[model samples]
Target: MQDPTATARPRKIIHIDMDAFYASVEQRDDPALRGRPVVVAWRGERSVVCAASYEARRFGVRSAMPAVRAERLCPQAVFVPPDFVRYKAVSRQVREIFLRHTELVEPLSLDEAYLDVTAPRSDLPTATAIAEAIRAQIRGETALTASAGVAPNKFLAKIASDWRKPDGLFVLRPHRVEAFLTPLPVERIPGVGKVMLSKLHAVGIRSVGELRQWPREELERLFGSFGGSLYRRARGIDERPVEPDQPVQSISSEDTFARDLPLHALDEAIARLAGKTWQATRRTERIGRTVVLKLKTAQFRTLTRSLTPDRPPASEEELRAIALALRDRVDLPADTLYRLVGVGVSGFRDREEAMTQPPLFE
Candidate 1:
């Protein structure tokens, strides 16, 4: 018999990301918010934007910006708290749409994913077509829009997906990689953040094309192991495979309230999100060993607290209890208000292994 894996061709990878995911969901659910500047987050002293619609973005409102600052930037912007349960439901619907075309679906988050559709079920011959179909299906089914990018590899595909905004699709053909990357700023390269940009600027490397001219030895001297990787990416070379069964690294759920709620009312929000987190774990069917709580104050500062139980919680109630216990670690004033709350489960274990173990009480 022939080796089954040997005959497989190079994969065609596509990345799909929702446009202004939280804010878009809010707008889709409320017809009144359509075409308006929408910011999904609480409004108050400590609140920050969880997501901002394209309309809001025009005025410089952005995710993680203080709600007060966003309002100042776009006074007419409407603020809506995130409805995580609804978002998760829509995410699952999108995933199901992907499964209709290919089984090799790898979710990066609720709003983005990578799909290897080289061998799609439909007669779609190209990754671009697959992405288009997926985006269309998501829009038709949920009334929310998405953008997609198609390329020969994951790195380029992710970049392409962001090239256009709202309901756009971009395809980066293999031969055009270098031309596409050359003119962009060095900061556009993955892993090159503010600090890295300063370091690169010190060397007079300001753009992708400029980085390509640097001697390999010089890059290695400056960035160490990362320098070599950067050199390859600058030239649009990425050999990483499109892994179909990538392990689930983490599961989390967060919500932005319409108004900053008192600290005491957090229990209700946490309870609601804990159930959503449990449902997310069910989709992956992984047993998580740690529970975490995330909070963003109206002031825009973010905080997270986590706990590793002797063993993973077996029920949603148990998860909520653990998450609530972790919440006590936040040093909030008695009158302090919160704009957002989130719950997450991480450090997953195999389902079979988890089931075979003795019960918590036993």
Candidate 2:
């Protein structure tokens, strides 16, 4: 048997990301908001920032931060509520531009995507050139900006896309991959969160260079499956392909309350969230079998309970009932106060696949 990777050709992948997508669209449509700070979010105590323009970022505003905090960071920032209908229209335009170059386009979200242009349909001489063309087209057609990263694989491409912000392109040539990654902090790796960082620090591993010194066996012993991943990433060895049209794995709706509520007070919120999630799920053709209930305590600790029914939820009322029932499985103290609640549906299958499954008692 032959080794597949050994004979495989180097891939040319490009990651494209719209710069401050939601905020930029707001600025683009309204000329008066162009030069100033723009924060896209609802103005509410519980609202969170959806996107912040470069101007707002300079004031320390960031996406997902509470809206109230964002206001404190940039008092003069213009806040605009998100208009997903408009954003989706612009996203479709960007997707059309990607299809002009390659068929292997994987959209990560409304504002970012990965394109495998190893064998592009366009006559661009290099992957870098393709990225440039795409960026130019986005700017020309949408009156907005995008950043691009050209690399041999998805991981590097994603990292490189963010290397230069707003409107820039970075190409990571194969020859320079090692030198580029060597000095990077371990936290730069996608999965290295705060917990992982503390673990790496305790072991005196700070940079990719430091992490590279550890043997895979030791790393794996310390970190389990993730340790194996850290080992590969430290050496710039990512071979994952850009899979196009990845199916929607889940849909959810969540809310944060202005005041923390005891467990018993979550019933109304859970039902409301379940209704929102059910409506969102209706837009998809697949059916979901699992109902998930999530809660965040006042201390910010998160917990989730999920149930997969014998049959997928057949109506909004069924979804709401299952979501409410999942709350019963939460083992937190009765007095525990929760600041957030979420309802979600997952375990999706095509309508035919779901219908074909034998009934629990046929």
Cand. 2 Cα-lDDT = 0.90
The residue ranges of model 1 lying beyond 4 angstroms of the native Cα positions read 1-8, 250-362
- Best candidate (score: lDDT): 2
Query: Best candidate, TM-score-wise?
Result: 2
- Model 1 worst lDDT run, 10 consecutive residues: 1-10
What is the number of residue pairs that collide in model 2?
A: 0
User: What TM-score number comes out for model 1?
Assistant: 0.71
Per-residue lDDT of model 2, residues 135-222, tens digit only: 9999999999999999887888889999998699999988788888889999999989999999999999999989988999999999
lDDT of 1 by residue, 209-231 (tens): 99989877889998999999888
Q: TM-score of each candidate? A: 0.71, 0.93
What lDDT score goes with residue 58 in model 1?
A: 93
